[model samples]
Target: MDLTSNRQSWAVVGGGILGMTLALRLREQGKEVTLIEAARDIGGLASAWKIGNSVWDRYYHVTLMSDLHVRNILNDLELEDDMRWVETKTGFYTKGRLLSMSNSIEFLRFPPLNLVEKVRLGATIFYASKLKDWKKLESIGVCEWLTKLSGRSVFEKIWKPLLRAKLGENYQHASAAFIWSIIARMYAARRSGLKKEMFGYLPGGYRRFLQAFEKRLVDAGVTIQKGTCVQHVKRTGSVVKMDTADGFEREFDHIVFTTPAPAVSKACPGLQPREHGLLNGIRYQGIICPSLLLKKPLAGYYVTNITDDVPFTAVIDMTALIKPEEVNGNYLVYLPKYVDATDEAAFSRSDDDLKAEFWPALKRIHPHLTDDDLITFQVARARNVLALSTLNYSESLPPVHTSIPGVHVVNSAMICNGTLNVNETIQLAENAAVDFLKLDSRVAADVAGSRCAQAV
Candidate 1:
């Protein structure tokens, strides 16, 4: 606990919540911490942008009642008082009709599934929610597991479309644990209170929260370097050397990489072939989300699941959950398409091109919506938003401590048992920081012992 005697300096790469959280914790433990971010601002995927005249999240994000990790961070920052919770409604766009599916009554009357199939579907959700052992579910494919439990009709009508929407072509290879975690989280939220699907959001989006977080980090004696990309990372015995894009290099006692696994391989090429292979072997699904500022609501539902053939995966009316007054009384809608990262066509499309292509589908979902109602449109793309949770995913994760001494790798890909989200990311950072500090302590002790032996 006497960290002052050790006096080790640490470099936390990547400015996402994970990196920021780890940096803060490490600093609190008396470590000299430096946070390097590639972008001008922090927050990574959780980062925000100016929408029309107001600032909002680039992609859709919500805090659930079960997100204790997120709540803890908010409490620490004293931003918990700014949280606004709302009971949201869900819609389903199937057979070319937009229908509400928020409550039991709507679900029972849903036309896609018969009464028997609906009952089977409910049973499947209940069973998944009660599941305590997720390891066994990892070996089973989602498609196979859902079909077996919910029956083929329910699987095809309900599970398949949702899986496709979130994972694109990788859904078939996903493990049953993928769906299990989602079901469990949603179930926990309902059980927490009024049995309603309520989500929380900060009044000024995450901008104010992130600004406050940056101030806290700076105030805690942490060095924050923004708009700096780390070009290379090389570990030399007890010291880790990092070279930046601007041809600047510095030495640190420890380094924590919070970027994607592939980025780690690129930064530190000295890693063993097996280590590099493990990092590179992981696949990710990218997202092209377009946030539209509209004058009116789209479907009057927070999230509208798209089951029919549509360009985008889902339509999220952020204004439905977030009050219109928050965004200058303008409705905010997000159309997100989850595609394979290798899909060049999807990634190459310009914002204007996407808007034109997706506008027709938006019209189909909301017939009342018109061009006159549109205020502005912005497109945001993330290459590695969610890791493809395939079979044996947990076994494939690389250790936090890599083969390179004084260097560590921690990112979203390591989240195998659960879905990729802010809460899970924060939890991973907290756990990784503990492991990193423990390893650093052992290494420091070993170095001191070696020096004493040499003196003798």
Candidate 2:
């Protein structure tokens, strides 16, 4: 699908799905695209690695029926037809007991809240789903908004604990838009016939999709530079120059930085002080996710939300949604702990030390479990997994078009109205690609006009 008319070179300095999308989009616009990644392969957070005899996603991921952007990407990769969809249930660990909260009946029967509290909680979700002015939510604190809608008891017994799990103490700084975005997405799924709560996944997970996507990029004549760390990026004259840590330098007509805000700030020192400040203003939440391959399933529910004190945030039983045969008849579970990226204590604790804290909680949740059921245990850590949706987040975000002539910054921090997910990421890339091409055209026209004026 080469649309080459007047080819211009582009350098995308990140190989995640967002970067891959940008490269592919640029190439379709008749641009020579080069994707450079610091890691050995693409799929930054979505990458998979060996876990004993099987390979699966390092972090837990699921495709909701409402995630049209993700489905579109799968369609482009020709993997949409092979997707497997399954209905799964949800569980809640509260008040020293494990309970089912999947359907309206279970939710009404939930022991943590009385009848009135249950009604308020349900009403809160329904109201949030109908909200259209999410920007107004950014001005209000999450705690205040939830407390007002769900009442004090429901906020304390239910909402507070869940917020603490996902955002830690940083929930204090979050806006109402944060929770609204989440409810909107879930309701959107319900609108798509997921009232049964259906989730989908590819057979081989993202690894197979990434392999196919990489091959497609290659077929489209896009250059892939893997395992290359970009040290510095600057614009000189009409083009942007990038210096790699491996003693390699390359120049392109324009550069699009798809890295995190901090990394982009470090790589491009030529940006304005305001741009640097905006980049530094963004905060991120990190995750320490441990994948446990067990001989038997812990709970049949797909996701178990915990309100009780636990080392990890939630329990994700992958086998509940995916077939056990996918992982050689072994059940895969993810115990994820979300912490502030600056939390040195949580990040510094070793694998063995974490296991010491986590194993006890696992047994506490499932009292009948024993050590022999565990086949393998692996942990995955990331420093800046998702940007925090702080109050007025979008207002403080660095724009895609920077002060530098041929440089642009596009990252997850720019995701204002949506939660951090692959779907939102792909949509961001699509919008950024359009903006980039328009900026490129304007810059090129300006350069040509200047040359004509000089000749006259």
Candidate 3:
């Protein structure tokens, strides 16, 4: 499949992991690639910010042992030795107490559920993990399925609150496939010999990986245009043209939009009205996460699930998995709240407002945590962090190939059976690149045949 003689120019309109990976792959296949990023920096949702002279991820992220896609990327970058794996602990904040539920013994001893209810819950998890066809679960609501399998008592006390924390008010409308994917991922992490839940992180975090990847892209002759916002995309004859915010226009043989659905709709107005409506109708959930640098550790648990109603959804002690020495010997904790991305009020709230609202809730869990223990606090907002996995969500996803022949759409919203993570994003990018190249090869063959027929 050497495309050297039939090289096609491509424009990847997004700088996230998906866009970056796709552009790199296309370049490797002898295609002229130009990656356009609206943001000044790369990494998108996985972007990082400076913290007291050290850099860390803007949001909490970790690599599960089962994330083979991520591992492959690391290996390609020659960073396998940089990975550090650690067994992490999980905690449940309910009944006005923090309970450890990392292992089977602890789960059975949990106070919220009786023995029978706990048994049913365990069986539900095991059953869901073993399921191979997630499409079957798409028609069933998550709440209804969980209740039927784990009973109402366990559903309300455990599953409901956790679902609300992640999906907000849309949890009830979510499909059973949402929970099935989650259980499958967690189950795989514990299947090893030790059966411990282990997570891996690079010593310097994802920032290190992105830096290496960007360097490779440049060395491989991929054009990276940063801080360039694409306004609209149109197909003119056999080429795709992009209009940027700076009044500059560029043309390419093919265009791949790796942005969210809303951005995709905005950039490609030439799409049919029906196609536009479907893309616009897709909804997303946002996050307002505040990272706190503390002089002392607040909780030893890697993640504390809040079953109780609180200002924030979960308390994640990133240092529980990452050594404090990595970040200048300071503990890092993240308090995240998932909200509707369309809510103007939630997106407009100030960092001080979020701190004031979440401070008391933080104190409840760490009674000893005081203002003196906090070194600094920063807030990060991702307006379209996760796509809402509503029931039959797969049916609503726009096709990868749009009405415009050369234009394609691939984003987190297309992830029907799995959660949005780095690994899934990479997998989607790889698959989309393969599909695009195959289609391009067919088009080239057709053009060649037409020219020969006319000559004859």
Candidate 4:
């Protein structure tokens, strides 16, 4: 009973955060794995850049105190020293002014909402804070649910703008459950004692975490084939056939598709227009990173949230969030804009174009900050591949195990609620590995070369 490349082979598609974490675990268990990445680097969505003897994350990624899965992985890699937690700033920019709201005093007396509205908002959020399970709330709309419970004014001012920022034009149709999940995480999880609380970061930025993962993965003997894409996946009786980018045909015993649903449809086109209809329904948004090499701190807060005042959704100052000293007189910022599938205008625009558009919004957010404070700046937009998780899009997400026997698909698109942190990615990956390894599937042992006999 021997399994060679001809007999037992496992392939992991996409070398993003999710794929890399899963690949490391699979290789440790003595499984021969091929982690294929189209990108030259391993960090996918959260990749890093080098600048003047230092590296910074493509987009800011922070580890929550509640991020246990990421913590475990860090410990496993023995990279505890590389990580350092710092208390970052969080503020709201509303109606032509910047509000430094780091405490309850600011909360009870915020300018946007009147006193009665503030009291109601407090009570409603406090109530929403309690409800962890959204099963019953899923059927209802967020607008209706919040208005009925929290009052219409609160929804119009706070929730409406917040939803508009995240989901774009699709906010009204969004599930109350989805909205509540975000609120619950903000309220329930405490980084410090404060609710709607604190966030964490690694000392050398997220590049440290990515490097740690890469080192461990290489050490674990996982074959990382970078700059390669899997073109097609076909099944011929027992063996799974793959057509790669370089016109090479690889036959595998098991295969996992960690690419986005859109990519999945392209790779396995035969399953689509029918059986795997969910793949066609999935949507996604594009994110932009605007890192400013500045002479001084842009704002006192790391997270500068926005409801109104400009076209940009939210502005993030990374230097304020991570160890500011490491940033060395430079400020890094990230701006997220939601775009539809056919609308490639935002995605197609050059980084210079993005900086042009986004630069005005920054001025609007903080008018007092002069041109002299800004030294040099660059905007880095990723070649995005993750899917948009709308309302019950989770229900529509393609599971790890496909209807077609051995094809497994797992990506951020599958994740419905909760934060899309590295920790969540690891959990999703391991669960997906179990499904592909057939550990989650109950099969009577008639292993005909990794193909379980379907009951006749």
Highest TM-score model number: 3
Q: Could you tell me how far off, in angstroms, the CA of residue 195 lies in candidate 3 after the best superposition?
A: 3.5
**lDDT tens readout by residue for model 3, 386-408:** 88888788998898999998899
lDDT of 1 by residue, 324-355 (tens): 98789999999999999778989999999999
Estimate the Cα RMSD of every predicted model relative to the unseen true structure: 1.7, 1.6, 1.3, 3.5
After superposing candidate 4, which stretches have Cα over 4 Å from the reference? 1-7, 51-54, 191-196, 382-386, 440-444, 448-456
Give the distance in Å from residue 104's predicted Cα in candidate 3 to where it truly belongs: 1.2
TM-score against native, each model: 0.97, 0.97, 0.98, 0.90
C-alpha local distance difference test of each model = 0.89, 0.89, 0.89, 0.71
TM-score, model 2 to reference: 0.97
Local lDDT at 68 for model 3? 93
**How many residue pairs collide in each prediction?**
0, 0, 0, 1
Q: After superposing candidate 3 on the true structure, give the runs of residues whose Cα lies further than 4 Å from its correct spot.
A: 1-3, 192-194
Query: Sorted on TM-score, highest at the top, how do the candidates line up?
Result: 3, 2, 1, 4
- Per-residue lDDT for 316 in model 1? 93
Which lDDT tens digits does candidate 2 get at residues 1-456?
A: 547674889999999989998898888888989999999989999999887689988888899988898899899889999999887899899877889888777887888888999999999999999999999999899999999999999999999999999999999999999999999987776633325687899999889889999999999889999999999999988899999999889999888999999999999899999999999889999999988888888778889999999989999999998889878899899999999998999888887888878877887988877898878777899988889888887799998878887788898888899998999999999998888778768878999999999999
Question: lDDT (0-100) at residue 12 of candidate 1?
Answer: 96
Which residue runs of candidate 1 sit more than 4 Å off their true CA positions? 1-5, 192-194, 447-456
Count clashing residue pairs in model 4. Answer: 1
